[model samples]
Target chain A: MILSILAMAFREIRRHKMRSALTTLGIVIGVGSVVALVTVGEASSAKVRADMAAMGNNLLQVFPGSARRGPVRTLARPFQEEDALAIRREVGSLALVAPLATHSGVAVAGNSNHFTNVWGTTEDYVEARGFRIGRGRVFRDSEQGVAVCVLGNTVRDKLFGDRDPIGESVRIGSLSCQVIGTLQAKGANAWGSDQDDFILMPLRTVQRRLKGSRDVNSILVSVSRESAIPRVKSQIESLMRERRKIRPGQEADFFVHDMKEVAEAMQEVTGTMTALLGTIAAVSLLVGGIGIMNIMLVSVTERTREIGIRMAIGATAGEVLLQFLMEAVVLSLLGGLGGVLFGLAASLGMSAALGLPPVFVPWIIGVAFVFAAAVGVFFGFFPARKAAMLHPIEALRHE
Target chain B: MTPLISLRKVCRVYGAGETAVWALRDVDLEIDEGDFVAIMGPSGSGKSTCMNILGCLDTPTSGTYRFRGIDVGSLDRTQRALLRRHAIGFVFQGFQLLGRTTALENVELPLIYQRVPKRERRRRAMEMLDAVGLAGREHHTPAELSGGQQQRVAIARALVTRPSLLLADEPTGNLDSARKFEILDLLLRMNRERGVTVVMVTHEPEMGEQAARRIVFRDGRVESDERLRPLEARTA
Candidate 1:
């Protein structure tokens, strides 16, 4: 019996094909947008996480002073090399600490001159910053005062072309240095800055030859174990404060940043964006449901005589209600299925166009499908009730 | 044996007080099993109202109506619908066959409401269609069939459930003279062969004279009741 009623409902919809398609259009668009937006957002968020992981593993940085200006003490000078040494010596959980100084200069190799960033750090820089050499070797600990440099992938490609750059000579702002190694390729970072667009040299080389300064701008530290990060961070902070002669109650001039914290903040931002877009899409679905309700009410009014005839033929009011309700549900489900296909296509197209990986989450599709059916039930109730409540005699007499 | 239908002082009032219209008033009637009763009246004389009450589509505002010894007025809407589905059938003047459905499916409708299985429903509906001389036209929709064929399909539908009481309101009113006689002959044959209690409402005296019994109404009350050897009986 139920199957027959359902078949009747489908027949009714087929009888008015154009109107049924138009009525379901709203749901299709609503579900399509929701799935596309959520899936693309998920892909972008995953990209953010992958980029964060690429930044460094269990890394932390301590800057000269608090970048935040409100109520925190400002340092009068940049961080000296002694701060990096002190953190390495005093913090037992720390595995490696390297003072970093960066400057931008034109690097001329043979006839090629490319502008790139130059970094000055110790022999421990490669291990602490998660960098691997593709060819040749890093500078020896004893070669700090010598003029030698390691080239990044981008700088090597720009200055050396296809030739071997290990023995080539490059001029860094009037100072000549021999290339000792070439770092492996690392793609763009989270901020979209090219990771392989810089050169690394021993601290004395960049400090003496490039910047002519003795102060290091930042210190990069890597912990030996993941669980030791919090302890090492606090120890480094206290050691820096004591080294800088800050009072017990005074706000420290330096700030320590954990890569995990940055990654979490980025995740939160993307999560909120996905939720906001999802809410807007859900509103569209609600509007689509309202459209369904309007059409269903009109359908009930138009088919009054049909309802009367069915009732006169011994159909109960409940049967009429179920028939109309099932029609609405079937319409929404069809729309939802179409929308899922559309959304997947759209997401794939956008992903290809935007250079982001496509992310398909099963739960989101399941939820959207169920929500569409619920919309049918909720919005279809009023019209179904109106159809069931019609009086057989009055309805039969209706013109 | 108990009568097939009994109505005692049944009254259906439309409104209250000074604006009230009494569609049926203090009407007492009885219909025995296997009886072919024709209800004849002019417009506003309440023949249709009487049919509605007898078909259980409407309840009398006062007094009692009993069908097969069960109080119909006391039954709820669902119960009345079930009673109609299982024990009563109706034919309307409009033919009332669903316009877009095939004649076979239209005959199968009452069986569907009865929740009969698909195979049995098709078999029974086919048998009824064959009985109505529409065997080759089972797949034709109402619009594809002529007026007489449409009324035959309606009759097939009405009898598909093997209803004990068949109530037809102006079954031949829309037919030409020949088609009217054809339908009248069909109804008389069903009444005689199946012993189905057939109650039909018509305005033509000739149609009324064809029934085994006739009741005439005027001003919402029965004016004359007569029993005669119907035309079909004398011919048979």
Candidate 2:
């Protein structure tokens, strides 16, 4: 019986194909935007996570001053080599600690000259900062006092093009340094800055030879276990306060920043953004359902005489109701199918254009499809009931 | 044997209190199986209302209406619909066929409601259409068919379920004089050959005279009842 009713409904819809298509357009656009936006949002979030991971895993950085204190910035006392040593020895679950000092200068190798920031640190800096040596070896401890440097991939490309720079000499602001190795290419950070644009040098070589100061601007610490970061961070903070002779309850001169926290915060922000977009799309779906209801009511009114004929021919009110309801559900389901196809195409196209990985969220598609059908049911009931309640005598009398 | 239909002092009133308009007043009627009866009256004389009651489309405000020994007034809306589905068929004025549906589909409608299998339903509907002299015109919609052909399709639809009772209200009203007798002839043939009990309401005296028995109503009351011919005489 229901099958026959559904067949009748299909015929009815096919009779006025243009009106049915126009009625379902709202649902199509609603579902399409929802699918496309959510898929793109997921892809961008994944990209952000990957970029954060590339920065460093389970890593923390300690800077010399607190940037959050006041508008007028004051430079606190810089960290010493002992501060890094204290963090490695005093803090548990320690992986690697390197005292980092940086100086921006121009490096000239033969005829080629490139402007770059030179990072002055120990051998642990490469491991702490998650850098991979693609060519030659890292400088040893004995070479810390000697003038030696490792070139980033961009610096190699700029200075030597395709030539091998290992064991070659590069002059950093009048000091000629031997290039001991070259780091692999890491494209860019989230901030759009080229990560592979800096050169790595020994800590003592840059501090004593160039700057002539024993100040370490920042300390990079990589924790062995992710779960122990909060504990290790607090321990280092207190230790730094003690070494710098700061009393308890006084404003600390240094701050410990963790990469994991930044990564989690970024994920949360993207997740919220995705939800906001989805909610706006859902509102459009509601409007689409209203459109369906409006059209269904008009259909019921227009087919009053037809409904009367069916009733006179032994159709129960329930049967009439089912016939109209089936029409609505079928219409909405078709729209949902079309929307799914449109959304998949849009998301794929956007992903390719934005250079993000294609994210296929099957559950979201399922949810959107089911919700479209539910919109039909929720919106189709009143009109169907109205059609069913029509009196056979009055309806037949209706011209 | 119990009569196929019995109405005991039936009263159908519209509205209530001082403004009440009685459509049927203290009316008593009986129709046996295989009897052809014609109900004739002017407009607002309650002939249509009487047909509606007999077709199970309306119920009396007071008194009992019994169909095949069952109290029809005691049944709910769904039960009445069930009774109509298995026992009764209706044809209306204006040849009320669905606008876009073909003759074959219209005839198959009642069988579809009865949950008949598709192949058998098609066969039966085709047989009914053939019996109505519309064999080659089964695919034509109401708009495509002539007025006489449309009325024939309505007749086929009325008989598709092989119901026990057929009620036609002004079935020939929309046809021309030539087409009118054609529909009357078909109804007379169905009644005589199949022994199907038929009750028809008509405004034309000539249409009413052709029935085996005729009853006329006026101002919600029975005006006259006359036997035009014996049922056995026509069947013979």
Candidate 3:
């Protein structure tokens, strides 16, 4: 019984080459888009995880409040510089502490002015975050209170071109600081902003000389151990409350920014995007299923007399149904296999051609194949049953 | 003599309520094994319905239909289907072969339903096609074959199961004289060579003369039935 059905399916495909190719095309497109989208999404998530680890392997962020409902430490109400120093002194789990300050304006070097943000950190900044110097030397500890600077690769390229920028001067607002080093390029972030286009200066240089005195935007704290992070954050929060003399039930004005927490948030956002794309892909699969049902119905109609002849020749209705159903499933399965092959090739092509990494997942591939087959079964049954239940005598008599 | 097919007071009423129409009424007949039988009548004379019942494609609404002492009237749809597949081989007036399938594939179809093994199925199907004088034409599809050859493929399909009863409906109704004779001769050879019981319906008296027995039907009932004398016996 199984053998006959399989033979019939093979014959049907051979006989209707164009129609079968067209029908299988629907499945190929459906599964192809789904698999490609999923693989790309997985690759992206993995890349984000690697970047987040590189940025801060042992960092923990503490927010003043939960996400969404609260304003993230208003610009006018800045976190105090003393809060960072206190977190460092009170928390024994700390490695190096730095109060982060950002000031965005036009930076002028060699008569070429480019709009960029200047991040202010002290000498300990190099070890606090994993900042590697691509060329020249990092600023000395003596330069913390002086006007010295390190340019990210893009800033160095845009301002100094191929010429050496080390020991040269660049102006941020009214202050002129000497460039000491060029940091390695870190590419872009999830927000589509370049991470390597910034200029870094000594904490006091920006606080006192450029932006004018003592106000810090956020605290960048590096924990010595992953396990001690939560405790260290809580200790900083409590010490801040004590130092600021804030009473019970009053909110603190300061917030901590950690790369891991930001990465988690970014993952959630992208995960939702993947789900949205997945839903669109699923709709296409449903469309493919409907395409199978539609084609099977047409086949049933075209083969009505043939069905009758088989019954007249002694085939049971079940046997007839089995034949058509098997044909449908075989069509989908072939299409699914073709789709997987095409999808993998497309992913690799996209990676090579566009320089976007594509990932491969076995479980997803298996699931897509099964899903396509299931679609065939679900949609093929009705039309096949219709063909089977046809009255043999009447069918035989069909013109 | 064992009766190959017996229908006692068989009636087939179609539709329901006021629309109910009787196709066959009070039909009683018995065909012996190895007999070539023809039920002849005009269109709407219930001859086709009788053929359907005899072929196990339809059941009599009322009365008894028994094949070799088995009450087909009591059998359900599946059992009747099994009987069709295993006990009877059917040929059609239209030469109802699947359009895309080759003659070999068409012949192997019924055997496939019979759950025959692949190698054996193809071997037997080709043998049957060869017996029908369609030896090299096994790979030709229905569209590629002539009317007579298509009918021959249908015949091969029917005989592949090695069924005892051969049921044919208007076997030559659509063919030219030459094609018609070719089909008739094949059926004759099958009946005489294999002792296969043959049941057919024909519009032409010349077609009826080929059979061993003649049953004339009109108004959904048997008008006359007679055991036919063979031409050789008459000449002798």
* Chain B TM-score by candidate, in order shown: 0.96, 0.97, 0.95
Model 1: interface root-mean-square deviation in Å: 0.9
Which of the predicted structures, 1 or 2, would earn the higher DockQ when compared with the native? 2
| Model 1 pairs in collision | none
Give the runs in model 2 whose Cα sits over 4 Å from its true position: A67-73, B233-236
lDDT of each: 0.88, 0.89, 0.83
Of the two candidates 1 and 3, the one with more favorable TM-score, higher being better, is: 1
Give the per-residue lDDT digits (tens) of candidate 3, residues A131-197: 7888887777677768888998889889988898888999887888888789887777666678788
Error of 3 at A63 (Å): 8.9
**What does candidate 2's lDDT look like per residue over A178-287, in tens digits?**
99899998888766789999888899998988788988999999998889899999999889889988888888878898887777787788789878888887888888
TM-score for the B chain of model 2:
0.97
Question: Model 3: runs farther than 4 Å from truth?
Answer: A58-81, A101-119, A140-143, A146-148, A165-180, A204-215, A224-231, A341-355, B229-236
By DockQ rank, best first, the candidates go: 2, 3, 1
What value does DockQ give for candidate 3? 0.74
Candidate 1: stretches off by over 4 Å: A66-76, A92-95, A224-228, B230-236
Residue pairs with backbone atoms closer than 3 Å in model 2 (clashes): none
lDDT score, residue B33, model 1?
80
